[model samples]
Target: MSIELNEADLVSVSVGGAIAHPGFPGLPAEPYRLAADGTPFLLPTFGGIVYNVSVGDRAFGWAADCIHPGVSIKGADDLKNRGLNVFSCLGNTAVVMTGQAQGAKGVVTGKSGRFSEQVIVHFPVEVRRKMAVGDQIVVRALGTGMEIRGHAAVACKGLSPSLLKALPKKVEDGVLKIGVVATVPAHLVGAGAGLTSEGGSLHIQTTDRAEVEKAGLSSLRLGDVVAIENTDSRYNHGYLRGALGIGIVGQTDGPRAGYGPGLTVIMTAPKGELGSFAAPGTNIATLLALEP
Candidate 1:
């Protein structure tokens, strides 16, 4: 059966911001963070235009933690940045409004940070090269009020109707079956927990390599769709028996104790109405045909 949603009623509006530079905390005496192994190191963390990385690339081997691909954008004003973060949905179309990359189009991939607040956009590498940190980008924000025709139990959050349609899903016997790269056990859910799921993401803790390997999460790629087992993300991310949450790997893996690959929650069903299967090519890049 075809996936039907109220795509027409969703209002598409403009939410724009300039690229943000990588942020730091309180001007730490030493701009270094301890890895899971307790090794102090520092590298590119988040924000700015990442010229080399893009969706579909492996989320590991990078010298950075919580790294975002393409252009990371946010309004200079804190309140406006929140608007940009909350309104921009995954798979929304974005366009460079000013600077050398004017008129260039992109896709909103994800949102990150608590206080820093950024909306991640995926642009072609060449288009990204022409972009600068202060370049303004306007996203055609939609999908916040999407309705999945008959599935009242399934709540959609931070997901575009376009991306939802592009998702590998099927409705069988009233259950929505989705394709994901892996199912993250509830024990591994960390960071951004107890926070609103409308924006931001939850990190999949990779401190225990053994556990990560056992759960088949060691090879998670950016933009990869994955299911969080026993997670209730209707309002906030928390553990609930028999609940299931589906999200896209939005950021890179980190070395911090409770930090790892961040997954932006897109769909959730409290009573396990959402089913998932191991699907290798279910990444956003593949589903959305993102280039560069």
Candidate 2:
């Protein structure tokens, strides 16, 4: 059966920003962050054109922390950057407006850092190689006002209509069943909680390595769609019994105590209208046909 959405009611607008420079938290020794094991390490974090990594790679066991693949962009003004972050949804089309890769297209994959307020876009490796920091990128942002027709309980957050269609889902017994790589329990839901779900991500804590392995999330890859159990993300990322949320793995696993692989919410239902089934190879790279 086919699911319906109010596609015509949605408005697609342009939100632009320049490729951002990777930032340091301004610690006494900037650019150095200690792992959960108390080891200081410095590796590429977020921002700018990342030609090597893409959406399909593993999210954990990486040398880097909070890695955002492809290009990360943000507006110069703080308020405008928030606009760029909030408006740019996953699967939105992004285009290079300036520099050597002018007119090259990419796909919005995720959003990063509360302070950085940037949108992550995935481009072909060759296209990324031609990009540089400060190059302008304009996203044809849509999905904020999207609604699943005939399914009022299933609310969408930052999921484009095209992506919603591309996702592997079916109506089973009056429930929307979606395929996910993993299902994260409410207790594992960490950072970004109590925050708006319109943008940013909710992390799955990795402090307990054994628990991560037990949950079958040790092999999680960036862009993998996941289900968060007992969580209500319709408005904010918070815990609610019997609630279910669906999100995309947005960033890599981190070494921080409360931070790990983060997930950007796409769908949530407080009434348990959303269900899931195990499905491998269900990442955005495959669903959206994203080029590395």
Candidate 3:
């Protein structure tokens, strides 16, 4: 799975200012409450490296929006958005190029959202402490021009060669089997719809307790790989029967109208792109030998 790309595919970006938490002003005067007696508060949305938490934790915070650290690039048009979101791969190196934490390094974890064109980066606690709003963070985007040896139909997006190599893949009979912790139904897919494969995430709808329980989505852990049925994530998120998308659970959020746990797209293809199979035990945590 070693992939080679020309210099033309690589790009860099400057970090935009941290997005301030703009409270939904139109809501009722009473503080938003969760589970009736739960804490009443406002939603904490985007920006900053959220430390002390990782995947697999319960989305228990009151009014917590996207529960992940994010960095955005302002004034990004369609082309720049694609370059930052599509070309950038998970596990790519991110370096703080300006401010007090200059020279600090981190890893690209996932993309935030289409509207913001933000990229999530994970740095050490100390490094994050030194970072501030608008601090320049440069990423070595390198996932473009990738192909899975003989599987041309199986499109690879936002995944590094090393990640592909580490992913638990096998050929059984004539079909390629990709291990996944769960198989999510298309109907349960929420949020991130209509977004491009570049730097975007698909939210698992957890508002329906039955659906969540039936899909076994409650057991999903951060970094766990999951397969989404009827999802064509090659370009934009779309509905195409029999299409399959394999993604990593990147972030979690409390109950929202149309959002839930966030999944970052790693590999995807249309129907018949490749023989698809799923099973538990395959996840980025296991592949990278990191604790979940």
Worst 10 residues of 2 by lDDT: 110-119
Tens digits of per-residue lDDT, candidate 1, 1-292, equal 4788888888999998999988777754778889878899888898999988888888877888889988899887988888888888999999999999999999999888644378899999999889998999999999998879888899998789889988888877889989999999999999988888878888888889899999988888899999999999998889999999998888888788888888888899999688897788789998899986
Q: For candidate 2, what's the RMSD? A: 1.4
Per-residue CA lDDT of model 3 for 158-215, tens digit only, reads 8876577777677656445577888878998888888767667888877777778888
Question: lDDT tens digits, residues 1-292, model 2?
Answer: 4677888889999999999998877657667788778888888787777777789998988777788988889998988898998888899999999999999999999987744378899999999888889999999999988888778899888889889999999888888989999999888998888888878888899999999999999999999999999999888889999889998998888888778988888899998798888988799999999876
Residue 114 alpha-carbon offset, candidate 3, angstroms:
4.0
- The candidate scoring highest on TM-score is 1
In terms of lDDT, model 2 sits at 0.88
- List, in order, the clash count of every candidate structure: 0, 1, 0
TM match of model 3 to true structure: 0.79
Better of 2 and 3 by TM-score: 2
Q: What lDDT does model 3 reach?
A: 0.66
Pairs of residues at least 3 apart in sequence or in different chains that clash in candidate 3: none
Cα TM-score of candidate 2 = 0.96
Of models 1 and 3, which has the larger lDDT?
A: 1
> Which has the better TM-score: candidate 1, or candidate 3?
1
